[model samples]
Target: MNASPVTIPARRGKAAFVAAGQSIKVINTHGEQVVDTWAFNRADITEFMSMEHTRSGSRHIIPRVGDAMLTNHRRPILTLTEDTSGGIHDTLCAACDRYRYEGLGCTEPHDNCTDNLAAGLAELGLTPPETPSPLNLFMNIPWTPDGEIAFEPPISTPGCYVVLRAEMDLVIAFSACPQDLLPINGRAGKPTEAHFVIA
Candidate 1:
């Protein structure tokens, strides 16, 4: 366990304060939770993780061990060091927002990952103009041979986790996705806890 671990409850957001050389482990406490994660250079928020840049640099949509998470400046910010869940993880999907759910017949205001991320980072006294699309850990969005994209139930079981090592000091923010319309969270629409440890 980390000296100061944090847990983001289902349908909420939180931040993990970490430094360069430190590692962060994201654990699906109750399983089937898709955590949307992103990070910013602690010194400069302008230099933040860019999924587009990572894909361009790594040349793979589904990252593997040793893949560098690149920033908008095309610099490595973190590296995927370990993964206990061999299921699908997504890099191209954008975090859900209020408008997304409204389109899905959600009449009431919905808690969303984008807002959660902003709130989490605000707790650190840092705010970026916009939240970048995050690395969707444990998500199971697959592209089919017919060039169609499908949002399927997560393949991750309980206790699944992934470890990422920071390449630079970062203010990492993650949200236990509050998407109630998808099977990404095991068809429960109920978010689960994610154990975040920085060591």
Candidate 2:
């Protein structure tokens, strides 16, 4: 009943969409970093989220500890419900925009992550935005059984956050990943804020 105070800067990435009463919050003011999330429906987006139908219906596709970021038609777009990094977070990991710019070597234009996802999908108005397929919240990317997926470190810290309470009507987007070559934005990256609640 008290979740509001979003300072989500530090290599930022932001997106919002949560109805059915409403709820959205993300905090990690400093201490490892990674925030990427996407849950669709918002009327319908070709029944999105089909990473091969979530690894063939939840056999395994990231999100550990009780896992439930379920999708791929199974519904329920988030259910890790609460975690403090213990479960780690990151669905494979994909947030280094500008064509991943030489795999994030840095050209120094500032405001990366596809410009915070085109300003978080231009606040839903989408002036010049039309690119979907996302869901990253708290990126960690660590899995190498030869498949490969390095980019580790950063399971959230500084007031870690992860809360979801919506079962329908959603269209989330996030970017808290302005990457300067990447370190989960902890090298000189700063400036973040996101807060919303409606019980």
State which candidate has the highest lDDT: 1
**lDDT of each residue in 49-74, candidate 2, tens digit only:** 43445555566765554455545577
User: Please, what is the whole-model Cα lDDT of each candidate in the order they appear?
Assistant: 0.89, 0.57
lDDT of 1 by residue, 114-149 (tens): 999988888888776587989999999989899898
TM-score of 2: 0.29
**RMSD vs true structure, all candidates:** 1.3, 16.0
Model 2, runs deviating above 4 Å: 1-16, 22-33, 36-81, 87-107, 110-114, 126-152, 156-161, 166-172, 176-182, 185-199
- Return the TM-score for candidate 1, rounded to 2 decimals: 0.96
The local distance difference test score of model 2 is 0.57
CA lDDT of 11 in candidate 2?
Answer: 57
At residue 38, candidate 2 shows an lDDT of 59
